[model samples]
Target: MDFETVIGLEVHAQMLTDTKIFCSCSTKFGGTPNSHTCPVCLGMPGVLPVLNKKVVEYAMKMALATNCEINKSCEFARKNYFYPDLPKGYQISQYAYPIAEHGYVLLDVNGEQKKIGITRIHMEEDAGKLIHDEHNPVSYVDLNRTGVPLIEIVSEPDMRSPEEAADYLKRLHEILVYLEICDGNMEEGSFRCDANVSIRPRGQKEFGTRTELKNMNSFRNVQRALEYEIKRQQYLVENGGTVVQETRLWDDAQGATNSMRSKEEAHDYRYFPDPDLVPILVDDAWVEKIKADLPELPLAKRERFVNEYQIPAYDAGVLTADKTLALYYEEVVKLCGKPKVASNWLMGDVMRFLNEDKRSIRECPIKTESLAEMIKLIDEGAISGKMAKEVVEDMYKTGKSPQDIIKEKGLVQITDEGELIKTITSIIEANQAQAAEYRSGKEKVFGFFVGQVMKATKGKANPQLVNELLKKMLAG
Candidate 1:
């Protein structure tokens, strides 16, 4: 029988807060292990946890951006568990009443828009990391990540394919980054995903035995792991074998999922309200203020770029994919007042340079205004497009303005018609056969004459001027 895949993502995004979720410990990543811990985060006896107000604000911003309903009253609950990484044994998280619920994020998969339902977005604390020795059978636990503020965004099982799930995750990551709540850095474990995947009969209404896959740190891994899991489940069901409902870990190197343990339910965690932390009361004024402060999300900004700036949808989508890139594009457009040109340069040369150097837009060597100035030079016939590309390479290396480099390197285009004619005349005199070929209806040989002129002038002659002079001179 044909089968269908059902997938839902549980994303845990570490909030961009200065302090831990419930304690005054530092929320910074990549510090000496156990250095960022505090008495409360360490679960010391007689220590009471206090909620960080900034975490609430950050979570509210994300919820408002995702169009979720913020609960007026929510409280923290202790999720009892035992792990070396979790010093508290019971993590402080929201159980009965989460901060936001019933939100939806729109995703475009191959030009078809679909809304993925968000079941809940709750605030929680992150567990520490476990570092295992490669050669020895020993494990080390780093508590630095413990108590770090996290927003667990749980999605409904509405995605049917891995592509949809990947798109949903991308959209949600963009939202989190746009809201300034999360950095969305999967490399540093700032943003991670847990995929719950299952396979059922094509037309069945009920879900099959689902397996939870964790340890997906990147978008590609999420897609690959889901693809592997779906096939694995389908094979099991097809051969009259029972698919177990368990938690699995994605072995990225092996490109497969391994059974970790049985999936835990709410009852298994024995969740209870934390008495130390008071119930959060979000008022209308607070929610409204956060909504007002929300930045223009990726979708709205992309649409605006297409409509207002008259750029293509693909260009707008790419420029608005990252918050910094979008800001940089907008700033360059403001300086040059040419949206399409700016988009071309940004999407082509700027992105190329960034990728080659493994740098982000924020770390770009050339400033937005500098790039605008370079484009302005090319627009006013001060330099040829080819020459401008050379100038851009120099600017990338030396961080100099276009004019400064043009003057210092004497890279200005020779636009004088008289000078170009003299060079073309020299080329025609030297290459008589080619000129005869051009006169005998061999129109393609004109390019040879242009190349000769460019070479004679050491490539300083303006290509447009040469083409114009060559066509006029060769017509006779």
Candidate 2:
């Protein structure tokens, strides 16, 4: 029987707030374990939780960016559970009324645009981390991350393949980063995903027994886990075996899902309204204020890059992928005022150097103004493109300006027409056979003579001037 894979993603994005969701604890990622905790976040007795206003604002920004309708009134609920990592014995989250609902994110899979429906986006608190000692059978729990602000974005089961799921996740991540709500750093667990996957008859209208796959921190892992789950379900169905409905953990090393626990029904959590917190009321003025502060998102910035700067769509897409890279590219363009040249340097030399050094654009040693200066020198015939690349490499290593490098290395182009003519005259007399071939209408020989002249001048000769002088002397 033909089968179709159904997949949905539950993404938990840690909000970029200075404090915890319901307490005044620090929300910083890396610190001494348990250093950022507070009495309220630690779930001590007699402590009441207070909502952070900044968390709500950041959540609102994300909802607006993802085309979700924000609920004017929303309330928090208690999710009762017990785990070693959750000190509260119950997690504070939204149950009945979420902050955002019925949103859609547009994704382009192989040039075909598709809209993935977002079922809901709710605010919640993150659990702490449990570190297991490899040398011994002991576990350690760090409460630093407990009560950190999180937005749980749940998507409908609309994706059919792993690639679609990956595209959806990527587009969602871009939106989150663009909104400045989440850093979207998978390495540090700032953004995580739980994939729900099932397989049913190709034309069936009803859903299959879906299993939730967790522990996917990166897009690659999400796709891989989904693909593995799809095959597992298909094999079970083909053999007339039942696929269990449970929550599974993705073993990345094994490349398969292991059963974690039986899936919990909605009533399992025994969710109730939190009496300590009041219902959130958002007014028109607050929404308008956040809307006005929203920066130009990726799509709008890409369109502007293409229309205003005349860059290719591919280049625009890459330049705007990261907000930091986009800002850097824009600043370079502004300083040099050459869109194509700036794009080339940024994509080629700058990105290459960054990758080689394992650094981000923020850690780059060369400033945008310095890079612009290098490009400007090449544009004005003061240096050759090859020479400019050398100077850029030097700047990348030494953090020096183009003028300083050129002055230090004497790398200026020999644009003097008189000097170029002297070198051209010498090359023509030396390469007598190639010149004879050029005079006999073998046009390719002109390139040979030009190369000889450049080589004789140590590649500092202005290429245009050499070509002009070479053609003039060869004609004679």
Candidate 3:
């Protein structure tokens, strides 16, 4: 029997706020262990936790961006749990009332648009880190991350494949980054995902036993872990073994999932409304303010890039994948007034250079005006495309202007009609047999004469001028 994979992702995005959600401690990462801690964050005796208004505003911005309905009133609850990383003994989160609910994001899967349902998005505090010593059997706890603001986005079991799950995750990451609410750094743990996956018979209405996968740090790993887990469940069911409900950890080295512990149901947390914190009330004015400030999302921008710029959808998708890169492309197009040319250069050579250095668009050495000017030079036949290739590399290497590099290298296109005519005449004279063949209707030999002319001129002749002069001289 064939099996259908069901996947739902729970994403935890760290808000870009200056201070902790309920304390005045710094929210910066990579500080001395426990140096950013304070009495409120440490849960000291008689310490009152005050909510950060900025946290609520950021949450509202994300809700509006994702099309989630903001709750008029939401309350915080205590999730009773015991863990070393959680210094409060019980984590303060939303249970009975969450901040937003019932949202959706569209994904482009197999050239078709797929909509993924969002169950809810809530605000919570992040737990601390537990550092384990590799050399010895010792463990350390750092409470610096304690009380940091977080927004948990829970998706419905709408994805049918690992690829769809990855696309959905990328869409969310892009939106968050575009809104500037989250940095969307997976390696730094700013944006994290937990996937719950199961496999059931294709025609069955009921679901199979599911497992929660953790420790997937990157988007590729999330899809890989889900794929591995789905296969594992299918094999177990086919071999007459019962699939167990548990929490699993993805071992990246082994490329497999290992059972960690039994999964906990919601009732296991013993959730209850917190007495210390007051209920959050979001009025119409607040939601409208956030909605008005929301930036154009990735999908919308991609469509605009295609429709307005007359570029291919694939090019638009690649160009709009990153917010910074998208902004850079738009600036170049605006300066040069050539959309397709700008797209080709950025997506081809510019991206190649960035990938080779493992640098982001923000760190790109080539300036936008410089690239626009280079494209203009190519348009005016001031330099051949081949010469521009070298010039672009030099610009990237030294952050120099293309015109200056062109002048320094003396790599000017030979657009002079008289100079090109003399070279073409010499090529036709030397290639007598090929020139005779061309006059005898051997049209393919025309390319050979063009190659000879370009070689004679050191590839400096304008290609259009070469073709025009070659056809006229060969015919004569």
Specify the highest-lDDT model's number.
3
Q: Give the per-residue Cα lDDT of candidate 1 at 424.
A: 79
Residue-level lDDT of model 1, residues 161-256, one tens digit each, is: 999999899999999989888989998989999999999999989999998999988999999999999999988988999798888899999999
Q: Would you give me the overall lDDT of model 1?
A: 0.90
In angstroms, the error of model 3 at 383 is: 1.6
Per-candidate local distance difference test: 0.90, 0.91, 0.92
Q: How do the candidates rank by TM-score, highest first?
A: 3, 2, 1
Instruction: For candidate 3, write residues 54-97 as lDDT tens digits.
Output: 88998888888777899999999999998888887889999879
Q: What's the CA error at residue 78 for candidate 2, in Å?
A: 1.0
Clashes of each: 0, 0, 0
Q: Candidate 2 has what TM-score?
A: 0.94
> Which candidate leads in TM-score?
3
The residue-level lDDT of candidate 1 at 11 comes to: 94
lDDT of 2 by residue, 130-222 (tens): 999999999999999999999999999999899999988988899899888899999899999999899899899999999999998789999
Scanning candidate 1 in windows of ten residues, the lowest lDDT window is: 260-269
